[model samples]
Target chain A: MFNYIIVGSGFAGSVIAERIANVLNKKVLVIEKRSHIGGNCYDYRNKDGIIIHKYGPHLFHTNYKEVFDYLSNFTDWRIYYHKVLAFIDGKKVPIPFNFNSMDILFPEILSKKLQEKLLKKYPYGAKVPILKLKKENDKDLKFLADFVYEKIFKNYTIKQWGKRPEEIDSEVTARVPVCIGRDDRYFDDKYQALPEEGYTKIFERMLSHPNIKLMLNTDFKEIMKVDLKGKKIYFLGQEFKGKVIFTGMIDELFAYKFGMLPYRSLDLHLEVIEKEYFQEVAVVNYPNDYDFTRITEFKHIHPIKTNRTVILKEYPKDYDPERDIPYYPFFDKAAREVYAKYQELAERFDHLILVGRLAEYRYYDMDDVIKRSLEVFEERIR
Target chain B: MFNYIIVGSGFAGSVIAERIANVLNKKVLVIEKRSHIGGNCYDYRNKDGIIIHKYGPHLFHTNYKEVFDYLSNFTDWRIYYHKVLAFIDGKKVPIPFNFNSMDILFPEILSKKLQEKLLKKYPYGAKVPILKLKKENDKDLKFLADFVYEKIFKNYTIKQWGKRPEEIDSEVTARVPVCIGRDDRYFDDKYQALPEEGYTKIFERMLSHPNIKLMLNTDFKEIMKVDLKGKKIYFLGQEFKGKVIFTGMIDELFAYKFGMLPYRSLDLHLEVIEKEYFQEVAVVNYPNDYDFTRITEFKHIHPIKTNRTVILKEYPKDYDPERDIPYYPFFDKAAREVYAKYQELAERFDHLILVGRLAEYRYYDMDDVIKRSLEVFEERIR
Candidate 1:
């Protein structure tokens, strides 16, 4: 008998499991289909003894102090500020189209003029997305916006989402910004660093509580079949007294009553080389040129001193419900409508608390996932 | 009888083969120990359909028009200007420590001062090596030089050569330079490009001549025991009347009677990822961080539109006489003395012409090797 049964061992479920065991003194069973924990955040020591992320580069960054502080309890910090470069026109330039980038790409006169215009229009440290800048009436500003959109955003968006920049939702394009200042960092977060011992160590510490029972390589569907018994929850062919916390797909939980929700998955190619290091920075974005979105050198992320290095290349793929695990949820009108019906259906069970990126059918950063888990614990579990 | 017995099918042997078959209209036999042609320059489409350099990234760039024009007969050019970035202090700055790199790494005042000093000391397009720059008398220039040497050169040299920076030859450290200008390119050659169809295609076209017979998976040692018989060449239990061009290690040819000349070998790790592209550039160099020297993303070198990408990492290791294929000759005084003895022994046979990087015991760029082959043909073979 468990006090709560949590599906998935990703950040969402693990964070909830930690809180349930520590804060509420409850016995929690976390069911994960994958052999390993941490879901997309799973990292391990390779054969060459380099710590590598099995998935693409998961850069831990957030503006939320609470989320940062909570994670700090689990692992020490490496204080890594992530910076990215995009290969365009046979040159590696600073991404986010900052002032330094403008100087690198454009002519002296044109770059100066654009810089003056940008500084005049926006605050010194402001970050304006290409889509918002594209709506500008000024010709110079429009030109700058269009240049970034075409060179850096368009092809990447098509490859990443299988849709044109215009066809995709504005939020997708809005994530990539054009900075007015000379700060070349990819993210402007108050808390930006990698776990000193790697992300896996953090998850190891968080889920180490005695009350939290982790059952990996076991799917939620296999453990218990949920059914409605006159407005009472019955699971595993019995009246389940424990509360159910489903952190997997909401539509899958309800057996696709509103058809399948769309998602974008990634196929990652990881290689270990006999070299000490590879690449300039942690990640390099190939927006306009290559088929893959970006290449991440793991040594740059963790700075491990080894004779060998590991690198991962990310290829954007269409999620197959039967084959692929859901990664990024596609947020469109059709998806929203399908999710709304699922949300309404989920309301029938008071004991069932649907949460996390997959269950809610929304995209989330590491910090947001942690914050969401904390909020869910406070509102429902407590 | 063959007109020429060319040992090793790399640039050295292949160039001679092409020249002999086409220019002199002579029959030539090329013996390669490796299963494939092109020697170290051999690149092939792997299982994932991405072209990879079996050894490492080979960027073809040369100032000599004759060398470039001669090789141009074999394959079309991709017109690729190679640029490298160094991962130092958590920033992706251009290598060669150019004016732009100074701006990225140092404070505004210090960067401006150093820029002015560099411009004043060197020509607009001049590249001054770190060792040369370290000899500067000016306080500002010395600081700049020391900064680059410590950050970019020292650790990389230590890991690469297995020796301290001071212990390594000055010529070795003299190869990596500091640019006076804002040019972020690794090389400032007049002709800078890749073989449009990959390096293997060039070798394929070069060796496709009817007169050129390629015998792969065959070493010269296995086929023949070389001995001077009254100025007559004998091979494979038969009298061979042909010019023997040896491109393999000269010391190995003598059976290491004077003790084996030292050489460094590379262990390459290759991986095929399910991504379309990886990294912003073809090669990323890690100087201060990792044990491996660099990581090369193949798609950036040859842009083939595919859902997968290939990467190669190079790990430098001490050459084992029995196990490793000698890639780089150690230029230490003791090694040079041993090589001198081998050269003296090689000079005994009038028909035996020692050629290429390994045979000559010197590091030669792609163009230099081709140029040396032409010169050798004119002076000796012709």
Candidate 2:
């Protein structure tokens, strides 16, 4: 009898299995349907001899020190921080719209004056609103906002969000802040480094311990007939005997009796370029004129010594039932109401737990996931 | 001589100017380079008589009752929630991968086993690590993680991050969770809704105050020469008599003395389709198998009653100093170190204040920007 039968070898399942096995020295079995480990974060050199992430681009950024430190134990560190740029007005400016951008964007006199005005308005650590002109009755002020909207946010927001500016929340406009100074950093978190060797190394190290067992290219159904009794169940399969652990979605566990929830999926196209570098930055956003949101280059993320580079052109498409690796969990009210029904059904079970982004139906960063998993482990194991 | 000088007339600038002018009875002069208002969030009808966001799509969502109530003063609210879907493997799945996806994605026996295993493992609210199998020594458990990684993440990650999963961060893997159940909703927020009329209408009302003035096709540089002598200066020009407010880039403000900060850029290609609706969801993500990110359809975002629809194809590219808009700021350690120098230079000037995401060089959601702006407004006005 296994101490725990964990399902899905993704972040949630892998982390729990290792922790439980390491802490209690119990026997753990991890089941995966695909042909490899590391779940969605797995990476390897492709036929093009370029390092690639099978799932998608994964940049690590967290404000939590413990999460960073914990992951650091498994893999070496790389001092890489993600960068994003947008092609607009036929010019390249630092993303998040910064002060340095003005030099390249606006004429000398206009840029200078605009700088002075922003400085005075934002004295101290003040943040000015993008909707500053919204409540104005003055024709001039209103006109001014209209001008800025047309030049800066209007086109970009439309292409990105698929809605008009006024239709969006003022808060939405607020996300794109006007900068007073010249800082052009993509992220402002203290911890913006990358894994030195790679994420795969970390997974390899994390799963190298003795107490755990793994099955690749083997679905949970393969083990369904195995008798599971008297074991501290960590089942990540269809059936659980004792203390089964699930890291999948919460709604499907109950068989969607409350109706189907929504999710956003992704489709990617990749190519290998015969050059040392394809683009200077890691990712570039096309806000104004594109159906797609952005494109990514591998050299920026991997920094390999090979001359051949790989790039990914991403296109967003509707999620269909027949084909997709359901990625983003849709958490709208209707879906939530449906999910609530499933949650109620799940509550009926005494030995089952739902976890992770899919199970909880929340948008969580990497640190949050680890933090959440640790919290559960601390509570149950001790 | 100008009685009142307004900097940006977007939502923040326009709203504040309108409020101050109406409440304080002051004359305001608003200057704008672009021919329109609403800043980056502006919207209008195009040649097809279809309302569109000239810049990009925008969606409005907020939990703050005060914000909703405030915006409600302008236009009637549209009872619409944002929805997104992703097309993967020839199927359209709801975003935020849900339970119903299981039946569509996996074989019958495998799906059943996966559901049961996930439930058993996640019993009683226990959150497990998806990367747990990587830390296990058992060969079978390790294989499970590897399998899922290849099918779900390996190819996708390579396309998204431009790096192999091993080279990327495990935290990123943690960010993408698999759903055991199937349900599809785009966002998890309960307050997700859009304005019924559109963003332009709301802007018109927000900036209708009497004291505020309007100026279209007027750049900030043109107004710098018209100086204010005695009163407290809210300088929106290059040179100021009193206080100056800046909302541009910080590094360029002082010139690229510390060397140009790194940033990513993009290029976009847009097209108009005659169809009533292009896709089912608002946005779709392509993590693999594409050079571009995804395609966006305007009809889905706005849902206006029209026969013509617009769509855009997005492409991500490197930021050239001469081309593109700085949408995302790159936050590498090197960039921050350079920005630190600029920050110190900014501190020396007491008459200038830097504000917004541009000045701060941080990633903020729409609500956070509004909140930040409000905080700054409270500090300045009071």
Candidate 3:
């Protein structure tokens, strides 16, 4: 009998399963609906020996030392900063809209003026969100904010979320910021790198414990039943007393008791080009011109010895449960209210815990998800 | 008595000393003429609580995995890519002159034409030397090469080496390459970073072995003698049979017997400015503007919470044995001939081994020096 049942085999589920089996020395079963583990972070080698991310580019960056150290045990790292550029005014400029980007986009006089002002207002390395910049009363700052918004943020946000910048959560917009200095990296986290062997290896190593059993291509509904009225759960048609770590969609877990949550999906179009390189960096955003938000070249992230290069163009669209995969869980007021009811219902269960992006309906980064999982393991599971 | 006597506690000497003590379990004496260790790579926190590299900015970057793994024992590393920009034509552009620099310097149409020409000729990310680029038969490429050479390379080369590009060895000018891509890092080595604490700490930890003794403020000339005719080395006025790892200036060790191996020195002028940041990057080359070759802000390398910033301006000059530190050893045919003579003289001794930038008269990076030292230990000392 398993001491714990973890639904979903992403960082959240895999981490907890690994911890439960290794740290507690207890039997744990991990159920993954996907054919393989690593969930959305899965990457595999192509015919040309290029490691391509199946979903989109997942850059691992964080300021959390504990998170970095914890992940280090499973895999070695390749020092990669995850550079990104946004095509603006018929030229590609570094995104997160830095001083370098400003120099490329604006004239010398205006670039210098804007840079000086930004430095004066914020610290050298301060990352100012566009929304924060929009609140600026200063005329030049307002102009600068408007320029960045129109050139680099608006159309992309509209395409990705199917909503204006103001309609979506501010947290989502804050992901891409205006760096006061010239650092062109996507994130200025203290620890920024990629797993030497694609992220799947980290998952494989993490779940390699003798006490952990993985059920791939298996849905939780196949062997598990939750009796909400009786406040009891049954596993394999028997009464189960062990904890249930649910990392799947909260709405679907309770069979949409309240309502369905909203999410943004992506149509990932991949192309293998017969060239040395398609672009200078790993990712490039087309804010205004293209229907797709961004294009990612895998070779830039995982440098391989091949003349052929593979590129992924992401077309963000409204997610349908019947058709597409939920990539981003952006919340509205109604969705938040519904989530609150789900949380209240989840608390009613004695041994059930809700976690991960889908469960919480939060836009958590890779490190944030791991951090939460670690916290849950320490506070509840341990 | 120590089994090995090493002069200069830099990466070259310290690495060998540590290996001898730990790997071979042999007693090693490391003598550094300076009051401190780490040679030119020494760094410490100043009054403002900012780590400052005493001689100059020494950013450690290498493609050698073995060298990186070897050094990992002594210290952890922070992710740092040394970004250098040159002030050209009233604007700061990324150095090693790339597509980005070309865009900044040339008009839009000209920049496009030049970039297309470069791409057609070279693969993406290929680093081309200015000399090679200058010999281009293509009219557009030649024009572009001429412009880059005149604007960026020529003046900096003249200031740093005190010789025209045509006059100096082609090897010296090849160090600063023209990257075809938009990577703004001064060096694009696979591993680029700085020690987490400081370089001095690494040196301290490296020499912490009980078998390794460090002698500071002690010149080997004060106690050690080399008998050319006798082919003997003596330490503390006693005939010593231990291996002597000499990493000091080659000509000085032999009392300028082959005249003097030419070197370039720097006049480092440090200033503490009452501002948050003095520049956008850690280092900025002022090729055509000021007398000083470059300015480096220490805060960028080691970010700290101080309103006042510290910067170092380096003024290049001819090396004087009486004064100034020998920073760069750029050799002419005569200097190379002189170095060959010194190398032959040092090779005559039974146990004397010369390694490092100064001793070998080679422009070795930090990793190269460590690698050579490790090689020397394996081949000779071990």
Q: If you assessed candidate 1 against the hidden native complex, which CAPRI class would it receive?
A: incorrect
lDDT of 3 by residue, B115-189 (tens): 888899899999998778989898988887787788888998888878787897877777767889898888878
lDDT string for model 1 (B261-362, tens) is 887888888877777676778878788777788889988877665577788877888888778878887798888888888888778887899889999988
Worst 10 residues of 3 chain B by lDDT: B210-219
Residue-level error in angstroms, candidate 1, position B288? 45
Superposition error at B265 for model 1 (Å):
48
Kindly state the fnat score of candidate 1: 0.00
lDDT: worst 10-residue window of model 2 chain A: A227-236
Clashing pairs in 3: none
Better of 1 and 2 by lDDT: 1
Q: Pick the candidate with the highest lDDT.
A: 3
**Chain B TM-score for all candidates, comma-separated:** 0.95, 0.77, 0.97
Candidate 3 local lDDT, A171-253, one digit each (tens): 67777678999888787789999998789888878987767766554567765888878878887567779999999998888
